[model samples]
Target: MELALPTEILEDSRNKGVVTALYDALSRRDAEAIQQILAPDLEWWFHGPPSHQFLMHLLTGSNKDSSSPEFSFVPHSIAAFGPTVLAEGFDPARSIAWVHAWTVTDGIITQVREYFNTSLTVTRFSAAAGQSDCSIATLHCPSVWESSLPGRVGKSVPGLVLAI
Candidate 1:
């Protein structure tokens, strides 16, 4: 069954499109495509284990100093809340999962905040924040989700925690 995004998210088409295109470019491992979507000076932040930070290089295909393994992330869900877009990406082969929140402005992706293997924990906050009834929802705020990945059951999905 296909899940539907909330109406509020649907209303913000431009940001949503930018988020979707960014993921699509990453999945294709198309550096040129990614560059087109990202801002010239993108601000990327990584949270969690130190190793997880390498994801920025992976996404941008810019690990020239070391040999980076090629991997694909399938986004299970995507939602746009205001200028930020939240997505859950999972690599079934490696049993790895992550939630990425992209901040888009003027058709360019300006910032990306990635949380590795911590979708469920952060999702709980979405419910409490009352952003939306959907599994994930975005809010127009600065606070981001912070949680550990453990005892998480079922498929790895991304959720948005809105502070509004």
Candidate 2:
């Protein structure tokens, strides 16, 4: 008769695969695959620097070519923080984003967050892609104000302000 492992062991094993897959997808710049693993109602919150803007700048190849600074995760350790999985890694060049993910219910990832030094990226790309600093991406988030406003206020904000 086959035997099943304990729940904790199974969960932990899955965590490793999930973390590895995330890194692989990101390095390959596979946005579709990245979105696929996340839950449909995913709450992806970002901190540190504006990666989206950075990506745009990078792809434009004015600041940096589409190719990112080659990075590979040197996993230091893995731990579960609340419902989130934290994979600590050391990137000698500090080029890649450090990811944190919170999964809830049926292996569905509910939230995801990433951190990285934008200044470094901007500098690196500027040198590599041979373009002057067009505009360094800022970290301010419009969502901060939106979130503070009353719920459903977003629906009203648009109608209230008619562009003349």
Candidate 3:
């Protein structure tokens, strides 16, 4: 059965859809698709540990190493306020959670702010503009060490920060 979402939730869902589409494009290495979603002059800021910087390189195709492994982002929740879409990325394998704030204008993403391992702060400030800060949702996992498995070991630490 199709359950209808409220108008506000539907808008938030649409914004989240954009983010999901962007991630899907990146995962497929489809530059053309990414170009369609991002503004001509995109501004991004990432705050976290260094290991996560690969996201920038990946998006920009700066890392020429073909052997680099592919990574995925799993968003747990998404909310929208004005032109901003705030989503949470939960990486259970690394016991980490990141919040991404994407600002879209005319269906194009113009700016992005990523906060890794800072879900608490991100959620606190994700309330509607002019509204007092309110708590946001988070994803929970039982085990985050799966990424450390023998062959699955990743070079990047459990922490990460990337901006473009």
Which predicted model would earn the best TM-score? 1
Please rank every candidate by lDDT, starting with the best: 1, 3, 2
| Candidate 3 regions with alpha-carbon error over 4 angstroms | 1-13, 66-68, 122-164
> What TM-score fits each model?
0.63, 0.46, 0.62
lDDT of each: 0.67, 0.45, 0.64
Root-mean-square deviation of candidate 1: 8.3
lDDT of 3 at 114: 74
**Tens digit of lDDT per residue, candidate 1, span 79-133?**
6666777777666665667777788887898988877766433322234464555
Which clashing pairs does model 1 show? Answer: none
Compose the digit string of candidate 3's lDDT tens values, residues 52-161. 66567777776677564655665666666656776676666766666777887767899988776652332222344555645444322222111111222443434432
lDDT, model 1, position 119: 49
Candidate 1 vs 2: which has more TM-score: 1
Q: Which pairs of residues clash in candidate 3, taking residues 3 or more apart in a chain or in different chains?
A: 52-160
**Residue 135, model 3, lDDT:** 46
Candidate 3 Cα lDDT to native: 0.64
> Candidate 1 or 3, higher lDDT?
1
